[model samples]
Target: MASAALIESSLSGIPVKRGKVRDVYDFGDRLLFVATDRISAFDWILSPGIPDKGRVLTQISRFWFERFESVSNHLLSMNPADVPLPDDADLEALSGRCMVVRKTEVIPFECVVRGYLSGSGWKDYLATGAVCGIDLLEGLQQSDQLPEPLFTPATKAETGHDENVSFQTMSDAIGQELAEKLRDLSIQIYQQGSEYAQQRGIILADTKFEFGILDGEPILIDEVLTPDSSRFWPADRYQPGGAQLSLDKQFVRDWLETTTWDKNSPPPPLPEEIVSKTREKYFEAYKMLTGKECTW
Candidate 1:
């Protein structure tokens, strides 16, 4: 039997900040991040969340956090029980899907690094020959690898798609020194992740990172390099002319495109088959990347 999905988490006496797929509980010195099974596409949260989706995401992030220990990050503990919780809190539900992290003032921009021409980047290149103000060579097909990875920063929107902006724009909003540092760091991490994923027979096409100010220095925060934040493609099935199979929520997006519902309205509830397949894809990514089955 399949496990019931956790769409939302309600803890007593804890002030929580709920995003589309995660609930962040404020705990004075630290924060508890609970990844729910809720899935979103076209910026709309869909119904009937995928089973064990949150566990896969949280575990994958934990794997990367441990692997990148030399890198400064906000992860303090993976055990939610380490922090205070209500007497009625469900430890079983939170076991594999929560993180106790140092609280930091989150930066307002998404540090996106793209190594392939796809999605919005391909669309932007087709129309303007540039992506977020960085010009690329002509004649590049969809899914084609770029000459070099580009650090494209985007404004973090609360309720809609993150709008891509130029590096200069990011510098203007923040500062030149900080912006340059984030750009360099974003590209560096992307390169390391991409190379490693290729060895696992998966291609890390693009990814976005969130950073925060911790004790006067920038540290990586939020979910790290998971499928929800990065594009993962099977190396054996890749082609450059058009869309390739991805191991993420792209399955949900593709299914929605086949339906008549306009993206302006709330998305339709995902079918059972779609939900199951989506869950399988997320789990497959976790296994391939970590070399361990997603037991959670």
Candidate 2:
């Protein structure tokens, strides 16, 4: 089941910026998003891309985008066959991983929500008895489900760790009104997604969503809750006061922690076993949530 990993798309379109995962191409009024199999850890894009990673990421995102239609998003189409490209451009590599979307002015902050205590949010809570400056009751152990979800926003970083900022700081940076809107929408989306996933035997511990403004109205953009952007733990094995097994990139992160490679600088390449297992984790998340096998 080793599928081709498209580290980069060969399709031709007006040039746009490339990110750690998706490469975007400008097409006049629309944009083309090609999610590659590229995987990044500690902010470094590693070598030997995971097989079929792009297909899983793109398709899982499409499932969430379609399910959350109540929240307007930038998505236009996910079918590569329907996406227009220049003559002679090969789209075989982009199948099931391409999105043609309406372009908009992207908001610069990360809209994050946490249903469970984990990751950096756990670290923040341990030190401050609060996460993102929101006071929480003490004695909340690691991986413990929060009494209620909290809107914790971070500034998206280009080359380093995304700095977690308080709601007041976010309001100071963006207008208070706009900041409040993003917070509300982020919580709503996370709660709904978490509830659905819980019923399906997955715990969406936390997830991030991006939004952009189209004609002065905020619309969800970028990738919404994918394994790369969220922490998904299997419900059956869930435990508190410690780390939980996840079907997300955190699995790779846990492996990386045992390595001699420092969080800074270039990351080491993944072994065949690691890559294979990681691919299974990603595809399984897609299958478990969407209830359909990836066509690839």
Off by over 4 Å in 1: none
Per TM-score, the best of the predicted structures is 1
Candidate 2, residue 240: Cα displacement in angstroms equals 0.7
Candidate 2: segments with Cα more than 4 A from true spot: 81-84
Each prediction's RMSD over C-alphas, in Å, is 0.8, 1.3
Cα misplacement distance, residue 41 of candidate 2 (Å) = 1.0
Candidate number of the best lDDT = 1
Reference-based TM-score of each model: 0.99, 0.96
What tens-digit string does per-residue lDDT give for candidate 1 at 37-145?
9998898999999999999999999988888877899999999988999999999988799999999999999999999998899999999999878888888899999
> What are the lDDT scores of the predictions, listed in order?
0.92, 0.87
